[model samples]
Target chain A: MKWKEKDAAMYLAEKEYVDTAVIPLMPVTAGKDMQDVVKSGEFIRYFTEYLERQYAGRVYLFPAFTYIKTKQVPEEQLKHWQELLREEGFNHFLFITSDASWRRTSADSFGELFWIPAFSVENMEVQELAKTMEQQVQQLVPLMMDMWQSEEK
Target chain B: MSEKNHRVSRRQFLTYTLTGVGGFMAAGMLAPMVRMALDPALEASGGAEFVSVGLSEDDLSEEPQRVDFNVEIVDGWYTSEQSRSAWVFLYEGEILALSPTCTHLGCTVNFGTNEEYPDQFFCPCHFGRFERDGTNIPGTPPTRPLDVYDVEVRDGMIYLGQINQRG
Candidate 1:
């Protein structure tokens, strides 16, 4: 996860590109109960405040990133996620796919993952997607990078 | 001091005195009412909803890279925008959302994949990583990690919120 974030930022920096950072639509949630979305909202809020403060106003967490849209991943996978968070570090994005094998079950059924969605239609729909992303970059670059006075890591 | 002013007699004096008292009474009663009316307006300016990226727990790979999400945004009256975004992270069944927007130049980071080297996120902009934060690699153009996002699970559904710019 650390590598990915850094890698992603590098790619953008080289390309001199910036885009809107979207919170992926939630298809499946990770929780012990059936209705724990309120907690989820809080989590997003906390992160947003953190980003805004840390960046000192160069960017904003777009509103859509915090919406609970659906429930797609099975229960077992969600449990695996909780366990994985402790083991592997995922900064704060919900991820799943048929490839990320897990050893649990949801609704008395065991199944492999079907997909891990992170690729930006980079292949699914490149031209339109790139245009949309560029617009956001133009808008947020000025907003996210006010940290000019601060030194780099 | 015309006809109307001249008519201000004894009865009128008392009426004016009572009017002054009544004005004070009305203001006393209206202050809280005004606050209540504007309270919601003040609050509405804050925000609405979170950004939930639709990724399954299993699909999160151990490799760190950029992720994406698309959603509908409603602003003010009838205004709205369909937004697409990307973040960086390495997944191990955990949810980690990172902002892909480079803090330096404005450009979308393009993911460069090769059979020899592991997949890499490259920004064509001005080579700035670590603008957010996740995992760092040597020799990368990005000086900062992709921004981190706060994630939570509820009722078997996921909810995302604000981009973590410095995480």
Candidate 2:
């Protein structure tokens, strides 16, 4: 399910089946790295959208948690979001981002932080973008399965 | 002589010209209104069309494989391309394509993924299982069989159309 009104109704009706909450963490910066920030945000948006489609039954894709790029990770705000989602009955939390700063910081406490190297997709054709994301999603599926498996134990 | 014999009175000429011009003006004004009223009917009904999945007969085997394809979707005035996937394999010497969407909660099901659910499509969401032929296993979340795509083979290439619910 997605962060849409129709999907919200379905999610409420079948909350048990939809246990995973996916949030794309995007950084907004007006610095010298503005282009890079936009590129990574674009990639993360598309990546999470595809991931939600693949696992729509189980994943409730939340709107991206956007924050200003900073040296220190916003640990408190991130934890608050996680707590709210957990209280809302989402058992698994997956946070995907293309920002390297997230990987540098120990943000695993927030949730499963999925950090991918940012790739420029401004010039990529639609067909090529789909192929690239499909390949990456193939690798991501196993990671999610592992998360689900480990939690079961 | 004939023109004089069939002489048209000034009043008759005026009436005839007025009726002729008025009829032409009325038709011109109503033509656009009629077309606008029937515009919806004139439009081609929105139906799913066959799209090539970039797979040939040689790619199929007994084991089902995921095939991805791009479809052009038009919603209102916006046009976009969407990527969709299906599981394709050879079933009883015939090409078979099944939609990956699980009937229970719309999760993508994979074939031969879990060791416990071997030889079946397994939904990771709720452990829903379907048989090789996409029949929902008893006690699974799915209440019905997996949807079957209308398959067409042209030039040895596989093209899939709209999905039909397996009754």
Candidate 3:
């Protein structure tokens, strides 16, 4: 079954659908405002709708298994923070949620524009969030499949 | 002018027309409310609402069985819960729903037996034990029998309701 940004309650019906591909829309920030970390709320709201409208009959929509970050920590730094997750096998590859106020990205160098950066004069944009999401899905899918198969065995 | 007696004053005609229109509007407004009130009852009795798996009349065998069943709960949501492990034992061609709820403290009873207890449901909580027929052993912490599911057969299908305890 597949899940798009549609509706949260559709997870029940989506699980039954046999032939559907889960599509998590690429993230885009609401606007160019630097006032606060681009509102995760608005971004996810649209993203959620995008999934539902795009994949209505083709597949069912599962709730967004989302992760938000208040600051764009470069991919290098994130590795260290989640080192224990891999060591202890906490990465079940299931849907996950994060309360970080920042949008996600794959920047190796987290300059002021890296994210709602740490104590600086920079506000993140949609392009960067989308780019990060693109990379994350690609890298995470294989890891997720590995976890799923192990459970069956 | 021969039908003049059948005619009425302008105000009287206006009142009659308004009343007829008002009655039609009132019926239209109440039509939706009437349908909404009765639609749920209609869906409840419909046979397609929830299909039951046949389990009540079948003879229970002394074996572990996993019964799978699915139900369409809401219009868009199809919910299903299965017995990961269900124990079945024969009782004169009547199949019993042997739930794993422990009688002592409602903990799950384990069918895995030790050498000491050859055939009994062992409750880890308070060291309670029950016989195959679900009778609590004397000197055990359990004081009641395990709950049983209300079994109903409709067209060779078994529908189970709230679990009732054997008094």
Q: Estimate each model's TM-score.
A: 0.36, 0.83, 0.37
DockQ of each: 0.03, 0.67, 0.02
Scoring only the A-chain of each prediction against the true A-chain gives TM-scores of 0.27, 0.93, 0.29
Order of candidates by DockQ, top first?
Answer: 2, 1, 3
Lowest summed lDDT window (length 10), candidate 3 chain B: B80-89
User: Candidate 1: DockQ?
Assistant: 0.03
Candidate 3 is scored at a TM of 0.37
Ranking by TM-score: 2, 3, 1
**lDDT tens string, model 3, B7-79?**
6877899999999999999999999999999988867443443335446545447653324344333444655
Candidate closest to the true structure, highest DockQ: 2
Candidate 2 local lDDT, B77-119, one digit each (tens): 9999877889999999988899999999898889998898789
Would you give the TM-score of chain B in model 3? 0.56
Worst 10 residues of 1 chain B by lDDT: B124-133
Quality of candidate 2's docking, in CAPRI categories?
Answer: medium
lDDT of all predictions, in order shown? 0.43, 0.87, 0.45
Among all windows of 10 consecutive residues in model 2 chain B, the one with the lowest summed lDDT is B1-10
Give me the displacement of residue B63 in model 3, in angstroms: 6.1
